[model samples]
Target: MSRLKEAQKSSKGAAAYSRYINRPLGRPMAATAYALRMTPTQVTIVSAVFTLTGVALIALLPPTVWSSILIAVLLVLGYALDSADGQLARLTGTGSLAGEWLDHFFDSIKLATIHLAVLVCWFRFFDLPDGWLLVPLVFAASANVFFFGIIAADFLRRVHRLEHPHGPAEAPREAWRSGGLYSLAVIPTDYGFLCLVFALLWWQPVFVGIYTALAVINVLMLLLAALRWYRSIRGLAADV
Candidate 1:
């Protein structure tokens, strides 16, 4: 099997887009990193460089033929590096709590930064309605809040011996989330999909429509997940 196929075996689980697209695309790089004996944290720092570079371009540079294409490439590189870091960790058995925290912090900043960049982009150039700039801010909060909720649940679960702090939150086996057609569904929260939207900035109408739709989906999902988590862990909630 290819390195990607090997990496997939180690994937605990992921949303469809990550399972199908990002992982597969990142296998070769993961293999290369392993061959080079690179540490997971090193890969993460490199990934941050690529991600922040892409964000800088999208956030600061005006639309140009070359800028969009270059931004797309950088974002894709960042994503591949992101995938490789985890795989490298798993492959080398260097996956630590500290490393995981580092990775999540990087993702959190990148996530917030991208949305704010897009907000600026829209305000400066797009033909958007008044106050439409606030849409991205809402999406940013929704996504981050949902992420923090998951972390809180996982931490509380660990405290109560519900699961190990470092073990699988679900089952050991792959399921429907690993399916190929999941790309379409995962677009709602896929980092790559969001980058694609930025890359298509020349088409302001399409970007605005997609950005707003994604923002709404994120808010609804955040509420639904938070409610479900609260209900499921009501015992812990009461004790706290």
Candidate 2:
């Protein structure tokens, strides 16, 4: 297989847009990174630079036709680079615990700050009811919760596996999440889709409508996921 094909990750539980679009976009970028002898950590820093720059732009500049598109492009590129770092690590056998930590650290910062940047942008530029300003605040809280929940759940699962190496595998339960319908159903939660949404930032009303819809969907999804994750974690504790 080609290097790009070899670097591909399983798309089983990934959102539709991420599985179909972002990963594919990252493949060539990963290949390029590998060819350049770049470390995964370096690539991750580059991702952070792109992402943070876009976030800064959102807060610092009034949206314009051109600026909105630039923001979208920067975000999209940043997200693709986020995927590329992992692929590069996997391809080059350079994966390390520190590298993983750095990746998640940048991601946590991104998750915590992106919506705050939106809140800042709206405060500075958009003319809306004061009550409407709460949207990004709520969304920011939800995003952080979602990000932390996933990380915590994964850590707990790893600990459980270490404790019970021969326990029943999780594949059966995970199978449902791997399905195409599950992937499609979660597209609203995909960061790649959110990056694309920034392209409409110049249209304040449309942006607010879609952003509100996304915020609502994220809260609902996070609630459902929290319940499931709680049950799973409780079960793991019981098994210990």
Candidate 3:
């Protein structure tokens, strides 16, 4: 297989920006890291640095059209690097529990704090009413829950598979094959979409409207997703 093909993972439930844009960007970065003989842990740290830097910028800098664009670039680059680390691990055959733990640790930190950074920016910079602050606060909470729920679901699936090795295997998911419409449908839950939304930070009304809408949509999606995941996980026990 070509290096890119070898590094590619199943898209499965990934949202549009990640499935289509970030993973492709990361593939070449993963190749470059492999050529440099970099470890996945190192790439992970670098990814965290870029991501945290962007988070800090949102909290510290006054959001301008230019600064917002720069923030988007940094966050997007960080996200690509996040993708690259896993691909690099696959390429080098160096994937490990520690590496996965570290990757998820950083992701948890990012998911927990990125929206809080927005909260800080809104408080420190935006001239909004006090009630508006709740948007980011609620967003931050839901985002962390969303992130943890996903990882927990995956962990449970892994354990279920190990426990049921002799039982029937799972049917392969067909979500990715549905292509464009499914991808488009999940855009609100995509981090890359949120990153791009920062580009409108110069216009507070527009930014707030879009951001608030996304938060509401994500919260609703998370509720529905959690229920669906619960049903699926319960089925694993029933099948056994």
Q: Listing every candidate in turn, what is its Cα RMSD in Å to the true structure after a full C-alpha superposition?
A: 3.8, 1.3, 1.5
Tell me each candidate's TM-score: 0.84, 0.96, 0.96
* Model 3, runs deviating above 4 Å: 174-178
lDDT of 1 by residue, 89-186 (tens): 87777889989999989988887788888888777777778689899899878877877898898777667554344443433334654555544565
lDDT of 3: 0.90
The deviation in Å at residue 44 for candidate 3 is 0.7
Question: Mind giving the per-residue lDDT tens digits that candidate 2 earns over 188-232?
Answer: 999999999999999999999999999999999999999999998
Better structure of 2 and 3 per lDDT: 2
Best by lDDT: 2
Cα distance off (Å), candidate 3, residue 92: 1.2
List ranges where model 2 is wrong by over 4 Å: none
Model 1, which residues run further than 4 Å from truth? 1-4, 7-13, 162-184, 235-240
* Span of 10 residues, lowest total lDDT, candidate 1: 163-172
Task: Order the candidate numbers by lDDT, best to worst.
Answer: 2, 3, 1
